[model samples]
Target: MTINVIGIGLDGVVGLNESVRQIVERATVLVGSDRHLRYFPNHSAEIIVLEDILETIVEIRQHLDTPNSCIVVLTSGDPLFFGLGRLLVTHFPPEKLRFYPHLSSVQLAFSRLKIPWQDAKIISVHGRSMDELIQALQQGVEKIAVLTDHTHTPKAIASLLLALDLPIDYHFWVCENIGSEDERVQQWSIDEAKQEIFAPLNVVVLLRQSRIATNQSLDLANLPWLGIPDSYFCTYDDRPGLMTKREIRVLILAELGLQPGQIIWDIGAGSGSVSVEIARLFSDSTVYAIEKTAAGTSLIEENCRRFQTNNVVSIHGNAPDILHHLRPPHRIFIGGSSGKLRNILGVCGMRMLPGGIIVLAFTSLENLHTALSWVEERKKSDRSWNYRLLQVQLSRSIPIANLTRFTPLNPVNIMIISR
Candidate 1:
C-alpha cells in the first residue's frame, strides 16, 4: 500500500504536476474535503469526504491493510505546513506515505503583494485562539502573515487590533481566494478593515510602518547584548535613576533564561526598561509590563513608543489583582512590589508554568527578606523548588575635569526562584 499526500492550492487540479497528477489519477481511495473532491469529478477513485479527522485516519488505515492499495490524500497548501500531512504521517509509517507539497496560501499571499516573506512571522488562527495573532502584533514584527478561519475572520482580527490600540502603525492586506479567478487582494487601514467583510478563505498580512524620529533612537538593529541604555528610557524627571540600571537589567535577563515565544511578566515594570529590553531580546515573546503608579505607567508607555517596542504591553494596575487576567507566564521579573511582595510572589507561583522562572530584584533588605521567606515557604510545600540569590554592584566611568572617576551604582539584590 502506498499513501500519497498531495497539497492543492486554490488553483486546484491545474496546479498539480504530471508526477503528482498521475499519483492522484491512480489512487484507488481519494481522501479530501467536498470542495477538493469536486475538482476531480471524472476520477474513478472512491471519494471519501473528510469529516472526522480521527475517523478519516482509521479509514485510511483500513485501505492500507489491503494488498496493492493506492491511497491519495488531498490537502490545502503545503501538507506539512499547518496542514493534514503532518497528522497523517504520524499515523502511518514513513515508508508507506509520500508527500507532494504545493505552495502555501501564505506564500501566495506574499507573492500577490510582491513583498519578501523571509522575515515575516507566519501564524495560523485556524482552530486556534486569536491570542496568537495578538501576540505576533505585540512582538513588533515588521511583517506578519495570518491564516484565517470561519470564526477568526479578517474583520474579527482587525477589530481586535483596533481595540488593543496597537502601538505600531500597520497596513492591513486581505488576500482572498488566492490563485482563483475571483482572487482579490485589498489593502486597508485597521479602521477600514474592521467594518468590511471578507471571503471565508483568506489571509491577512500586517506590515508595520516606518517609525518617526524621537529623542531615543528606534534603530535597534545595532544595539549590543545589554540592550538600550538607561538614558534612552523616559523616566520621571524627579526620579532620574528609577529605571533598572543597564548592568542589573542585563544580569536579570540572563538569570531569567528567556526563550523565543515565551510569555513574560514584568511586575513593577518602572520606566519599562526591563520589559522593553526583554521585548527586544526575544522578539517572538510577549512581555506584560505591569505597573501600579500612574507615573510609572506613563513612563513605560513613553519608553515603549521611543524604542518602538510594541510587544511590551504596559498594564496600569496593581499586581496579583491584574495578574489573574494574563496568560500563565514562563518568566517573571518582580522589579517593584510596593509592600505586597508576598502576595505578588504567591500569585506568580500559582500561575507560572512548570519549570517557569521568577527573578526578583530588590533594593531594600526588607523586600529581599520577604522574597527569601517566600522561597523558604514554597520549598517546604514543594521540595522540587530551587532558588539562588545574587548581589550585583555596578560602577561606571565618568570624566571629572581632566580625570575619569568611577561612580558606583546602588547594589541590587536579585533572587531567582525556579519551579
Candidate 2:
C-alpha cells in the first residue's frame, strides 16, 4: 500500500493539475491538518487530522493490512523540507512513500524579491530554537532565509539582530503570505521591522548590506576612551562581526603593558580595533597595523580616521614577509597569523626589543597547540623565555520577550609571551 504525499500551495485544490488531482480523488484514506483537509471537503475518504503526528502514523499503519488502501497525505510546499514527509519516510519503507512537491515558501519569497537563493543559508525557526539563525549571522553569511513561527516572528528576529549590534548591517525583507492573494514582500530597516506586525505565514530574508550602506556617522566625543563598541569600526562586508570584541580588546591591552615612545606592532590587525585603542591611549607610541588583505587594510585606515588615531600606520601586506621592513617592536599583538604562526613568531622573537611583550589570541585548539609548540622549542634554548595562557570567555545580555539572556562570544585563548 503506497502513501501518496502531495504538496499543496496557498491556492489549494484549484492549483492542482489533472495528474495530481486524479491521485487525490482515488484516496481511500486521507491525512492532513484541519486547514489542509478543509480544501477537499466533499471527497469520499476516511479523514485523519494531522494534529498528533505519532498517532496519525499509527493509524496509517493499521490500514496497511486492509485490502488495497490508497493513502493520500497532503502537506504544504515540499513536504520533505522541514515538513511531515521526513517523519513519514522514517516510519514507512522507502518504496511505500511517494513525494509530490510544489514551490516552497522560501522559493516563492526569493522569486518575489527577484534574488537568487542558491547561495542563501536557509534556517527554520519554526518549532525550533533561534540558535541556527544566530550562528549564521555571527559567521557573516551574505544571505539568509528564515522560516518563522508564532514565537520567532519577523519582529522578534529584527529585535535580536539589533540587540547584537553587529559590525555589518543587513537589508531585512519580510515576505508575508507568499503565494496568497494578499501577499506582501516589503523591505524594512532592522529598526523599522521591529515595530511592524507581519502575517503569521511569512519568510524573513536578510541580505548583508554593502559596505557603503553600513557606514554610519560616529560621534567621537560621546564614544568611550576605552571599550569602543564593535559596530564603531568599518569591518569587511564579506566577513562582518570579525573584529576582536571590546572585552577581549581590553584584556589584550592589559597584557601588552604599554609605555611612552614605544613601537607597537598589531599583526593581522583586522579593522585595527586594538591598534586604534593603543594609538588613542598612548599618543606618543607609533602603532603599525599590519593586515594581509586589501579590504582589511582599507578598513584599518577608515577606522583609524573615525577614531582620529593618527599614530596607527596601516601596512597592507602579509606578516613575517612585511615585518622585516618595519622597525623592531617594543610590543606586539597578533590577532591573526593566516596559517603562518611559526614563521611570524620566529620573526617577532628575533626583532622584539628587550623586555618586549607579545600577546597572541587564538580561537581554535590547533592554533593554540601550534603556539605552545613554538614556545616549547624556543624555551629549549633560552630558559628565561616565559609564557602565560589565559582562556577568556565573555557574554552580552539580550532581550527575550521582557526578560534578558546571555549569548556568549567566541572563546579566546590569550597567550602572553615575554623574556
Clashing pairs counted in every model: 1, 0
In order, the Cα lDDT scores of the candidates are 0.83, 0.90
Which stretch of 10 consecutive residues in model 1 shows the poorest summed lDDT? 398-407
Best by lDDT: 2
Candidate 2 C-alpha lDDT tens digits along 215-331:
677787888888887877788777777889989999999999998999999999998899999998899999999999888898889888777889989999998899999999999
- Which lDDT value does model 1 have at 214? 30
lDDT of 1 by residue, 138-237 (tens): 4556788998888778877776665444334568899999989899999987778878988889999988764212343555667664655554566655
Q: TM-score for all predictions?
A: 0.55, 0.91
- Give me candidate 1's TM-score against the actual structure: 0.55
State residue 319's C-alpha deviation in candidate 2, in Å. Answer: 2.9
Strongest candidate by TM-score: 2
Colliding pairs, model 1: 138-311
What is the clash tally of candidate 1?
A: 1
